[model samples]
Target: MLTDVQLRRLTPREKPYKLSDTGGLFIFVQSSGSRLWRMKYRFGGKEKLLSFGTYPEVTLAAAREARDQARVELRAGRDPSLTRRQRQAEAKRVDKQLQHVGEEWMKAQSARWTPRHAEDVRTSLERLAWPDLGHIDLDEITAPMVLETIKKIEARRAKETARRVRQRLSAIFLFGMAHGLGRHDPASVIKGALAPLIKGRQPALIDLEELKHLFHQVELIPAGGIEEPLIVSSFD
Candidate 1:
């Protein structure tokens, strides 16, 4: 069922062309004479094409397997082509935001922060935040995603660090909004979404006798330093 043009797409370079058994996938020669696997399909009443990657790198078996999975998705009322396109679009948007914010943040801190502190903030953002959320659009960042990221930091018991990162992220989102890069400020709306800080409970004193004893203990310490009695009574 494969056409000659399609066969020629797989012209000999140093390898033989392999076609899928179902005739929907094939290895074809590219303009550069390199064999490439391509899949043809129809979804949502529209024809679509997908590249299975170049030869050798994608091997015949691997390409067929990938094509099979795509076909399975297509049969299940899904449009794999549209899904792929959306993912690509999202990646492009995220990359743009990351680059823009990174440059702006660098410029804003150069005059105010010391070299070491600047580097620390830059390095932390680049390493921790960039890898996961770098490519996502700042406006598209949801409260759930921000909460999830905060939870990751909280799990390590770095509450202060988590708070600082949240502040930085909020600033980045604000910057993006100011520059007209995005329409919504998702970070600004996460006040109630984050976990609340809990203050430690102080011990309660039941009677005046305990209070007098505490004061006596406190008086026995040095003038400049009240030591253990003060430390104990402070909790009261």
Candidate 2:
């Protein structure tokens, strides 16, 4: 067993060396005077190493417990080193969501879209959707969050615009999923969730009398002024 008194007496040298403890754990003393704890083990007939932690900060007892835990994980056919790396990679992948994937999807679609339309799509997201959803993790976004955005647009009497925004968000989510940025499209669950659009009433003359009355009013414009000709010709 490695004693605390012996550990405290360990001094740096011209080169790095390790003082081994039982069960593949060691205290690696570096020339720079940093004593870090390390563990060496084998999994699947391959040798792998794990770091328990540094000395002083991580006591002897703590290092031993960590080594025991690693052994348990190994007994269950799990490589602690590989598992740690996989978890780290997954965390990194999950962080690249929403804005990151969205920008990438837009770049890919730029070739297929007109410049004006591409800009319109970008503007819609930046001005409307991004404020709420841009920084969110792709998988973490929910239908309620997206619907709230649409409802905000609807509250402004922009029902058609809200529908278009929802469609864009859905497309972005799908794009993210295809590229592995998200697991599922949250917006897919809600369709027709926004308020229905009310079409505007068109103006029309009710009868011949109304039509003739409009024509009569037009004919009353004073003749020969530049504005009169322009105003009269506008009705044509």
- For residues 42-129, write the lDDT of model 2, one tens digit per residue: 9989888899778899999999998998899899999998778898997776556677777877898899775655676677778788
Query: Candidate 2: lDDT of 100?
Result: 72
Candidate 2 has what TM-score? Answer: 0.47
lDDT of 1 by residue, 145-228 (tens): 877876776565555455556677777777677777766656556656666654575345543333444455565578768443
Model 1 / residue 87 / CA error / Å = 18
Can you tell me which runs of candidate 1 are displaced by over 4 Å? Answer: 1-95, 198-236
Q: What is the lDDT of residue 208 in candidate 2?
A: 33
| lDDT, candidates in the order shown | 0.65, 0.77
Could you give me the TM-score of model 1 versus the true structure? 0.43
**C-alpha lDDT of candidate 2 relative to the true structure:** 0.77
Which ten contiguous residues of candidate 2 have the minimum total lDDT? 227-236
Model 2 lDDT at residue 132? 91
> Which pairs clash in model 1?
9-28, 9-29, 10-29, 94-135, 94-136
